[model samples]
Structures are given as C-alpha cells and as structure tokens.
Target chain A: MSEEKHQHVVPYRVYVIILIALLILTFSSVGITSIELGEYTVAAALIFAVIKSFLVLTYFMHLKYDKLYIRVMVGFVFALFLVVIIITFLDYLFRT
Target chain B: MEHAHHVEHPDMYDEESSKIGMWLFIFTELLLFGGLFIVYSIYRYLNPEAFHLAGEELNRTIGTINTVILLISSMTIAMSTTALRKGHKKVAIALVVVSFVIGFAFLVNKYFEWGVKFSHGIWPGSEQMLAEMSQGEILFFGLYFVMTGLHALHIIIGMIIMLFTIRGLAIGKVTIKRPSMLDNCGLYWHLVDLIWIFLFPLFYLIH
Candidate 1:
C-alpha cells in the first residue's frame, strides 16, 4: 500500500457520533409526532430532516472538506428549494 | 504570490471539484423532491383523514430498517472514498462492494414491501380497491409509489454502475492514476442513499 496521501483519515468514531446524532433526532421526531403540536409537527419533522441531511452531506459526502464554490452551488440549490415549495403552496392556496 | 504553475491544479480544486459537482447535482434533486414534498404536504393538509388512513396502512417497521441499512451503507461508501484517496485499493474495493450489497438488500426488502401492497390492492390508482376511499388517499399512495418507484429505479442504476466499477477495478482500469471514475460512481451511490434518507421519514413517519 502506498503511503497515505492526505492527512490522517477522520476516525470512524466521528462517523459513529454522527450516526448517534441522527438516531437521536429520529427518535425525538417520532416522539413529537404524538404530541399535539398542531401545525408545528411538519416544522419539527422538516427541522430534524434538514439537520440529518446536513450531517450526511457534510460528513459522509465530504462536503466539509470541499471548496467554497461548491458550498455556494449547494446553497443556491437550497435557495431554489424555497421557491419551488412556495410556488407549490401557492397552487394549494388557490385550490382551497 | 508567484506560484502561477500551482494555480492550474491546486490540491484544493483538484481534490474538491468532483465533490462540488456532485453536491450541485444533489441540490437539483432536492429541488425536484421539494416540489413533490410540497405537493404531498398540501394534499395531506387538505385531506387529513384520508392521509392518516393511508399512513395507518403503511409498513413503518420495514421502512425504518431500510433507513438504518441505507445510513450504514452511506458510512461504508464514505469509508470507501476515503480509502481510495489514501490509495488503499483493496479496502476501497471491499467497502464499495459492501455498500453495493447493502443497497441490493434494501431493494430486495422494498420489493417485498411493494409486492405485499400491490397484492393487497394498494397499488397506484387501484380503483377496484380505493373506489370507496377519498380521492386524496388514493392520490397519496399514487405519489408514494411514483416517488419511491423512481428512487428504486435510481438505486438499480447505481447498483449496475457499482458492479461495473468493481469490474473495472478487477481489470486494473480504476487505479489511483484514474480515480475520477471511482469518485463519480461513489457520488452517485451516495445520492441514492441520501434520497432514501429523506424517503424513510416521509412515507413511514407521516402524521
């Protein structure tokens, strides 16, 4: 095996920690579902979902180590997310 | 201030461009799904009772297990990419294969779940079955099958790509000198896994 080129690889322990964090979020989201949070239920699930997605993208997909241009591109995509959802909601609003 | 030659292929750019590209693509995918999720949310809000009934009929346990499997497979793919960056060919190959196997396992589990649902007259637009149910409930399952079915198709495509990459490595075409191919394959696999991460909570954990 050639000498490892990059700095020492991130330890598996870190990834395990991320996994634990996701599980905690998952359990908490499920726990909150039964509560009468009213409209907040969707918000809660989306919040946890966003957190989990961030963890996966940053750690598993190596975005944390990526360059700034990449970050900007990803940010732009997320910005589009709002536009798409809002427009969809507009359609829903008109129908109702 | 005079490192002009280094500007052409800086380690930062070279090491990260492919990943950035993958992120951009994933962003578009999220937009596409964001549209779908918004639609789902709207219809569910409009017809809460029907949505709840559909939710009650779903197989949550299987969905959770699949989510766990996909998450672990993602970790393995991350390890594989890291391994390759370090020129650990054997470990990288093994990890890739492991991820592929786990992905296939997910598909198999999903296959049976869908099969059961289909047999139970819960398929997309099964009028003979959903004739009495609210239109929203039928539409909910329709979108469910369409979204997840598209995802599964992507998984199948990813599996085939991984198998080819594995074969490429077996034939000495995927060495460090030509590592971009493997990197791209890993990106696609991770995207598939990422989609499943979102899908799990959406279909299974609906309130």
Candidate 2:
C-alpha cells in the first residue's frame, strides 16, 4: 500500500458544516412534533433521524474513509438487521 | 532508547486495522441491540395505545439534551482521532479529555432522570403504584429500562477505555506513528453515541 495514498486530511470546515447540519436536524425534529401529521408524524421523524444518522456515520464516524470491504461488511450487517426487524414486524402484524 | 526503537516497527498494521476491528465489534453490538429492538417493535405495534401513552410520560427536554450531548461527544471524539492522525498531540489529548468530561455529564444527567422515575414508582411490576398505567404501559417501561440501562453500561465501558487511552498518551505508549489505540477507542465511543441517537427517538417520540 502506498503510504501517501492512504494518508488523508479532513479540513476543519467539514466539522463546522456537520455541526450546523445536526443542529438543523434537531430543530426540525422538535418543530415537526407539533404538526398533526397523523401517523406519518413518526415516519417523518424517522426520515430526518435517518438523515442525521447518515451524516454522523459518514462524516463524524469516518466510515467514509474506510476500505471497500469494510463498507460492504457494514451494509451486510445492516441488511441482516432489517430482516430481523421485518420478521418481528410480521409476527406482530399478523397476530395469531 | 532501545525500547523506543522496538515500539516503532513500521511493518506493523496501521491505525486503520484497529479501527476496522472496532467496527466489526460494533457490528456484533448492533445485532445484540437489534434483538431488543425487535421485541420493542413487536410489542409497540400490538399495543399502540399503551406505547403512545407511556411515551408521553417521559421528559422530552431531558431526552433532547442527552441527544445533543451524545452528538457533540461523537463530534469531539472524531476530531480527537483527526488530531492524533495529524500528529497534533496536545490537541488530541485535549479533545479526548473533553469527550470524557462530556460523557460523564451525560451519565450524571441519566442518573437524575432515572432516579426521579424510580421514585415515582416507574419500575417493572410496581403495579400498586403503576395502577394508572396499562399492561402494555408496564411493558414499555420494562423495555425502556432494559435498553437505556444497557446503553449506560456501554458508556461506562467506553469511559474506562478512554482512561487507558489517556494514560497511554501520558506515558508515550501511544504516538502518531501508531495512533490506532485512540482510533479504536474513538470507534467504540462513537458506537455508544450512535446507539443513543436511535434510542432518543424511540423512547421520546411517539405519534
């Protein structure tokens, strides 16, 4: 492996940008709670939550700089997790 | 001087390997908590009324503050790793200390919040006092206690790990040439923060 190729630097500006993004997300989540969006209120909250999670995972967590295999492993693990969630959901949704 | 040369072996796997190992550990952690989430979701779906009503009793402000604290800690820990990688040892040490102090603050807040709830008889099977609560409401508290309790355990473990990292920095066992110790510690700390990110909404936000 080329040492120079693997060595990378993250600028300070990136941290400030992510901080602003998280603050915006937090405010929006609190603001949306009051709107009577029916059942979709939770759905909307989750959507923003997922976006915020992505920002933290990608930038703050540095998963963005990881190798391809590591990324694949993370994706596979999450896919398996979704399967578990889905199976449980079906179990509750179908009710014996 | 002899020991210094021994620790500076360039052929050793770099910081990236340690970070990958930490991530793989977190992968297992996800599944461990995923099992609990599976149970929570199934019960919540079956008892929507109970879940929503129980959720309303939680302090939204406390949950929100904890969320911001965890998020900021994650950012600071990330910057800590960045500083170590750039060979800025003093900045790196300062950032790690900040993360540790913030983490302690989070646990202190959690202690008070949980203490108040316990005083109000919000424990499992405290049916005489939880009489106003429904059966599913009891289950909600059960799950809440288990999930957040486990997360708190992880935070304490992360703090212990950070302590060792700090000691390593002080003794010069860790340096930029091999910064994986801090990187791995940061990875573990970030996972603790990420878990709370999900927990905050699940317990505090209900529709």
Candidate 3:
C-alpha cells in the first residue's frame, strides 16, 4: 500500500502502429481464409484470431503495461480456459 | 504522484486493487462466453457439414465490415484511455465519441443482417428452419443467433458504458490523476472486441 508504481503512459504513436498492424492482420485473415485450404483452413483462421486477440490483450487491454501480478492473473485465466477446452475436446474425441 | 491527489479524495483509491478486481470480473465474463464456445465446438464437431453449409448463408462481406468496425472502435477506445491519462480530456472524449458512433454503425449493420435472415424465415424455431434445414444447420443458426445476439448485447452495453465514462470525464470526476474509471471501461470495450475476434472466424469465415 505504501509503494508508488510508475504508471506507464503508452504513446499515441504506438497505438497507431498497433492499429495498423491489427488492420493488416484482419484483412490477411479474410483473404487467406477465402482460399480452399481444406482441413487447414480452420486452423489458419484460428491462428490469425489468436494473434489478434493476443495483441488486443497485450496492448489495448493494458496487460503489457500492468504489473506482474495482473499479467500472471490474466495468463492464468487464459491458460485455465485453454485447459478446459482441451479437456472437453478429449472427452468428445475419445468417446466410444 | 498519487500522494499529491490523495488529499483531494480521501477515499482510498487503490489503483492496483481496483484493476485486479476488474480482471477478476473479466475472468467470469470470459468463462460465461467460454461455456457457449464449448457448446459451439461440440456441436460443430458433431455436425461439421451442416455447420459449414449454414455458415455459407452468412454474408462474409458484412461480417468483414463489422470486424473492421469493431477493430476501429477498439483502437479508438484504447487511444481514449491514453489520451485521458496524458491529460487530453477533449481528445479523449472525442475518441470515445468516435468509438460510440462506429459502435452504433456496427449495430445498424447487425440489425439489417438479422433482418435479412428474419425475412427469409431463418430464425430459431421458424417453420422454414425446422422443415427445411438439417439438424446441423438448425443447430448452426441457433448457435449463430445466440452467440451473435449475446455479442451484440455486449456491444450495446459497452457503448452505454462509454457514454457514462464520457459524462464522468465531462464533469472532471475522471482525470489524469484518477483514470481508473476510464481505464476499466476501456478494458471492457476491448473485451467485447476480443470476443468478436473469435466469433468472426467461427461464424462467418468457416466456409
């Protein structure tokens, strides 16, 4: 409670650059998914989405600038989410 | 720095704890949507063909436009947060208003898109859906409406939150020294966009 944390004010230029990158990723996902990639299509699209979400989480959500405890909490939450999905898929996959 | 403003509002403003609390709330929201995502995956796996076919009926162009719209809104809100922290109240409010307008545009697009589907009797429990669509297709549309409907609802709520944050900024309740309110609201706005990142590919681009 006595500690003074130096608040990181992210630069507007950085936000602009991130926005441009997000736009590129958005269009790239759209263009690539439009092609016939067979089974890999879903995989490709999801990869783009995961990257996009990562950017949003890290920059826009201020997770990157936040303290370690906050980052750890977010990481834990997402990791838990992934584990749930994996386990659920296991149950579905191994069903007799 | 915080001590300078400590006297202004004696109410203990624990920034880190406040942010932590918001994150905890976000985890719950994530799980709520996460449950629906599980349902979607199971059904999609069970009925891939039907899900794929039904996914085709959705307008990819409109979906892409909405995706861009949301991404823009997310950027503006994020920028607004930075602006507020940097002591540019007017710029901050302007960015949020931009976000609000774009968000409304997104809803308008969704309304028309849903209207088109409704006109074709494509809603849940519609006679055409039940009689014509396969079970998988029905499930696909059902999930579509449920997922997208819930998402649209979030967008509306986020916009409303933005309005309040704007008012807070207008009255000087939220400022450079006390940016927690706007920061939390920005977090929520980004969460809405984060969900759509997954929803777009799953619902619209899966053909």
Candidate 4:
C-alpha cells in the first residue's frame, strides 16, 4: 500500500481543465432549459448532468486511478440501483 | 524513537484499506439518496404538471449559484489533496478553508431561499399549501424540502470534516506521507457535490 502511495499524481492542469469542462456543461444545461426543446428538455439536462457526474467520479474522485476492485464495487452498486429503479418503475407503470 | 517505532506496525497505516472503507460508506450514502430519488421519480411521473409547477416556484438563480459554488468547492478540495501531496501544507490548508467558506455561502443562500419560500407560505403543512395546493404539488414541496434539506445537512457535515482535517494539517497529524483523512474528507465533499449534480437538474431546471 505504501508503495502505491505515490500512485498517479494527476497534474493540476488536468484538474483545471476538468473544472472548466464541468462549468461549461453546467451553463449549457441551464441554457438548454430555456430553449423550449419540448420533451427533450428534461432528457437533455439529465444527460448533461450524467456527463458532469461522470467527470467528477472519474477525475475528482480518482476512481480512474483506484484499484480494480473499487471500480468493480462502484459498478456493482450502480447496477443494483438501476435494477431497483427499473423494477419499481415497472410496478408503478403497469399497476391496474 | 517512539514515533519511528510506530511506523513499524504496518497495520497502523493502511491507506488502501482506509480508502476502501470510505468508498463502502459512500456507497451506502448513495443508496440512501437513491431511495429518495426513486420516490421522486414515481411521484413526478404520477403528477408531472404539479411537479413542474412546484419546480417553477423554486428559484433557479439561487440553485445555479449554489451549483457553481459546490462545483468550485469540489475543485478546491480536490486541489487541496494535490497540494498536500506536493508538500504544500499551507496551500492545502488554504484550499480547504476556501472550500469551507464557499460551503458556508451555500448555506446562507439556502437560508434566504427557504426563508422566501416560508414567507410565501409554501412550507409543508401550511394552511395555504394544504388548502390551495393539490396533493401532487404538496407532495412535490414535501420532497423538495426533505431532499434539499438532507443535502444541506450533508454540506454542514462535510464542512465539519474539513475543519478537523485543517486542524490535523496544522498539528502535523496529517502529512504528505499520510493524508488518508484529508483524502477521505475530499471524497466525501465530492460525493456531496455529486449528489447535488443530480438534485439541481431534478428540482431546478425542470423546464
């Protein structure tokens, strides 16, 4: 573990770039809401949000550099969350 | 020599496992909010119009401000970790302090936002809301208050963690070689921001 302590020191420049990208995405989402895209408005905003969270999780949270097991754990948790959401929505959508 | 002897015990400093533990705790936090998000989706589907109306009542400007604030704070916390790793103790502490200040600003913004809502009689169980709002709209406000309120509570908790991390840095308990506490705190702060990333769109930009 100690040997891996020096693991991947991401350059400050990369952090800055990611921050800029996130801010740009944030503004874009806000702008898209005002454009009257009809049904796509919510979908667009949420898509931007998903991208922003992806950046945060991968870079800021250092998941990209984390151990394989940790990555697997995150993926598993997300899968479980998605399953729960889908099943619940199915129940609600089909309720007679 | 006592300090040197402490280093001999490998169990005393397992940064990898400590980080794994933090990640596990973070998963639980995600699921905790995931449940509320599920409820929100169901209610919104059932009452889209009411949810839209209720979302309109929220101040998008304030929400955007808070979003930017949290995003910048997230960057600062991340940079603080980098600074600590680079042996810039003072820079690291200053970054954490900056994040703390921004977090406080977020709460202040929240205070005014909620104050305006309360003054308008939009609070849960208010006679105005109960009498005038439909069941869906009422439920929308209820979830709004509960979800954002919980998120705000997390902001406070994250600040407290930062405070302790700053103290640890000041006293040399946290150092370049051993910064697991600071690192974990940064992860926690990022998690708070991550949650808000979703919350902002769901509640504010629902157009």
Best by lDDT: 4
Docking class of 3: high
Cα lDDT tens digits for candidate 1, A1-96? 333365346566776787778777767767776576877876776787788888877877666765567767777777777787778778878883
Residue pairs in steric clash, candidate 4? none
> Candidate 1 regions off by >4 Å?
A1-9, A34-38, A94-96, B1-21
- Per-residue lDDT tens digits of candidate 4, residues B77-100? 999999998899999999999999
Candidate 3 structure quality by residue, lDDT tens digits, A1-96: 545537888988878888888889989999998999988989999999999999999999998888788899899988998999999999999999
* Model 4, runs deviating above 4 Å: A1-5, B1-11
Model 4: which docking level applies?
Answer: high
Colliding residue pairs in candidate 2: none
Best by DockQ: 3
Residue-wise C-alpha lDDT for candidate 4, range A24-93, written one tens digit per residue: 9999999999788988888998899999999999999999988898989998998999999999999998
- Candidate 2 per-residue lDDT, tens place, B157-186, comes to 999999999888878878877777887888
- Colliding residue pairs in candidate 3: none
Per model, kept true contacts as a fraction are: 0.36, 0.41, 0.90, 0.76
- Candidate 1 lDDT over B1-207, as tens digits, reads 766564565444343455556566667777777677777778787888788788777887788778778778777777776676677889889988998999999999999999999788788667655676688778778878988998999889888988888887778777765665677787777777777767766777766
Better of 2 and 4 by DockQ: 4
lDDT values for all models: 0.76, 0.82, 0.91, 0.93
Ranking by DockQ: 3, 4, 2, 1
Off by over 4 Å in 2: A1-5, B1-13, B127-132
